[model samples]
Target chain A: MSTKITNKEQVEAFLESYDTFLFDCDGVLWSGTHLLPHVVETIELLRSRGKRLIFVTNNSTKSRKAYTGKFAKFGITVSENEIFGSAYSSAVYLSKVLNFPKDKKVLVVGEKGIEEELESVGINYIGGTDPAYNVEATDASLASLARDESIGAVLCGLDLHLNYYKISKALLQIQDPNCHFLATNIDSTFPSAGRLLPGAGTIVGTLITSSGRTPVALGKPSDEMMNCVKEAYHLDPSKTCMVGDRLNTDMKFGEKGGLGTFMVLTGVDKEETILGTNPLVTPKFYADRLGLLYELLQNN
Target chain B: MSTKITNKEQVEAFLESYDTFLFDCDGVLWSGTHLLPHVVETIELLRSRGKRLIFVTNNSTKSRKAYTGKFAKFGITVSENEIFGSAYSSAVYLSKVLNFPKDKKVLVVGEKGIEEELESVGINYIGGTDPAYNVEATDASLASLARDESIGAVLCGLDLHLNYYKISKALLQIQDPNCHFLATNIDSTFPSAGRLLPGAGTIVGTLITSSGRTPVALGKPSDEMMNCVKEAYHLDPSKTCMVGDRLNTDMKFGEKGGLGTFMVLTGVDKEETILGTNPLVTPKFYADRLGLLYELLQNN
Candidate 1:
């Protein structure tokens, strides 16, 4: 049976048990643009309790700087260093972990966020947000497409500007045995404004099928992202707790990282999913909403 | 043991057995812009033998009319009626088999070939080479994307002009439970000019992942395309032979359709693939090249 962190004592004890709190933003903190009530207060309370706050999000469309701005808009102050978006994580993994060559550039099939992250990491890249690559290809142009030996990697994300020209270029680039394939995340759907849209996985999925190659995905639920987070923050998994609304990405991520998990009923999953038999992921604690923690803090 | 027809008597006997012949163009008849030697003469010889020759190809980028032009360019005469390109097959299946409602439109994610085929079949369609759908989506424009209730189906093919707008529109249109999802083909690669390029499967794959739905694929190796061919040509499977270079697509297609299969070594597959133990597909006959039959016709 999972412990329900409802009362002041339960919430206080839960907070005391963990020194670090990793949060998934979209569902637990807010749903779309509407902020979930008391989330700001709860986050403040965690900070006041000396909890190391790290915002871990699978949304690869935004860079860490962009997330900081979003946080500022929500009246919560957060620095770029505190945000670990999939885009930023991917850039870090490529630059630091893989030691990507300085002479070669990454072929990006994503948005500005990915480009920004790659730039921040001092990695040269091509294709993302380029007007030249965002157009339809004709037979004449296709024949004229020259292979660039400088493209050492193909990085993919959710690109609203996805076109055959970009896909074809990436396909051609990745055919080289030396070129690496990487993806930000494979979340099948993007939850926005209370609706599901096609996510980065759709783009990556097509590349996987076309190239007959599986990319190293850097995001939640992937051990690679967890490794990046652990190395960057020097996090002790035993002292960390993952708080999120989703079971698949957040809860699975926490479990895989050997951290305590808390599930909130404000996102993709419901209480029935937790209570159901043969659950894919079981959270250590369950809360009605993130706001419940704020009430516990106040009452305590 | 598979007999290799190297001489005149064996080729004459093989040709005389099958009344109808299905050929895969890229490998058997030609390789890219350069037509294989003796292919034209062999085709003419088959025509003289009164064999019903059908050019069945998974290349959805070109319409039957375009194929007729290509055949003419290769110094061979073929009519649109004798061509069964995946684009034409899909259109025929949608119009003749499904009896699609005349009032609703098909949301197409493909090239002008698919559009032309749909037009020939009198099926109304949106998207495809539409200039409006060939660009990126903005946050403001994404909000403005509205559902078209008149869309009854989503057809995917080899779309060189693929954009997020088209994919998003198709995703929205297919959300209607009444809408059908169809694909021209799921060929992973297109062999052109001695190289492999991304095929229609890559386009359909992304849509499948995004929509969480599998489309009814109409192409080689799929029973749906076989049914369309059967209905249109009134083929007697027992007296028909499917000849091509690939074992998986062509031989499997022939075997599945209850027709005799002939493997040619001039395309994607080699003799080693056919001679190997536990082959995925077993063809009834094996030839070094399509031109072997031409030599037999001249010698006999």
Candidate 2:
């Protein structure tokens, strides 16, 4: 059973319970371009009380550097190290955790963000946003595509230009058991421009079905992402709280990592989901919205 | 236990047992563009014996009409009605089984073959091979994509030009619980041009993940397809035998339909697969290749 925080005392107690806070951006803080009410003030309030804040997102379309600009638009100050997008986390997972071969290159099935992050981590890669893959696959063109044995890993993320040509090449490379199949995240849908669009998981699902192989997902609800963030920030799970909207990804991620979880109703899940008889996951604490904590703290 | 058809007596007994033969064309009759050894003679022998022949393939890339031309290329006589492609089966399934509304249209996430089959069935459709979906998905363009209430179903097949634009449109229409989600076939991989390429299942998998909905697959191994062919030809399951190269699809299709199954080692599966302790689907009879039956029948 999960507790529903209602009053000012509950909010204060919740805030005092955790020294570090991990936040999910898209639904909790904002939905696409517009920021949610009291989000900026809530962050300011957390900052004033000396709470450590880290922005963690499963969106792999943007790199950490690009994400800084998104925060800047919302009048929020965020450094690269303060944020952890799936693209950057995947890069870290490859370099630090897997210790990917220095010589072998990664075949990217994504966009510029994955490429930028891989480059930042000193990893060699090809095929992401490449002009050659943009063209339609022809018999002549497909025959020209032989397996590149040099590719040690296939990293997939959210790609706007996903085509059969890319998937065909990915299938050939992933046929080798020696080659690693990796996905930045397996988010089924991403809220973008006020609509739920197909996320990275949809793109990765194509390869999985075709290749008959499962990938090592390196995002939310996976231990790889939690371990990467924990090691980098040196945060204590006992004192850290994960605040997000989605139950499957955000709440499950927090529970799996042994951290306190707080759920908000602004995103994919509703109150009925948690209050339902058979909920997918249970959060330690939940509120109508993230802004409620800030509203309750207002000097009334 | 399956009986391995070895001598002339066994081959003669096999031929005498079945009045109808359902053949999977891709790996059985031919590999790619070239006819397999003795395939012509075997079909000719079957015809001379007054056996009913039907070429049933899970490949949805080509319609039955197009398949007739391929047979003509190999100097074999085949009519349109003698063939059953997944593309045509899906159309029939939608019209006869589901009784899709005449006013409603289908949103295609496939190729021209599906379009041609849908047209043959007098089903109105949009999207497949449409220039509108051939472009990249941008915020400006996607914002213009409002749900079309008239689309009653979303059909998926093997599409070489599959793009994010088409998928985004599919996710929107499929979100309406009233709209049906249909797939021509869910073949994971298809051998093409001397290589195994991703199949219709891979394309449908993308929509399945994003929409979080399973489609009513109207192809091999599904009772929908078996019923369609069985009713069309008025063939008895006991007198019919399914001849093919794959176990999971071809063999399973035969077993589930209560028809005799013959496994040929010319394609996906091998003797070891069936001879193994836990075979996916065991055929009633096995042969090294389909050509062996023709060779055995030639002798005294």
TM-score top scorer: 2
TM-score list, all predictions: 0.97, 0.97
> lDDT, candidate 1, residue A25?
95
Evaluated at residue A205, the lDDT of candidate 2 is 94
Stretches of model 2 off by over 4 angstroms after superposition: none
Across A193-259, the per-residue lDDT of candidate 1 in tens digits comes to: 6557778998998789888999999989899999999999999999999998888999999999999
The recovered share of true contacts, given per candidate in order, is 0.77, 0.85
Of candidate 1 chain B, the 10-residue stretch with the lowest lDDT total is B189-198
Question: What is the interface RMSD, in angstroms, for predicted model 2?
Answer: 0.9
Write one digit per residue (lDDT tens) for candidate 1, span B63-90: 9998899999989899989999999999
lDDT of 1 at A219: 89
lDDT of 1 at B231: 89
- Which candidate number maximizes lDDT? 2
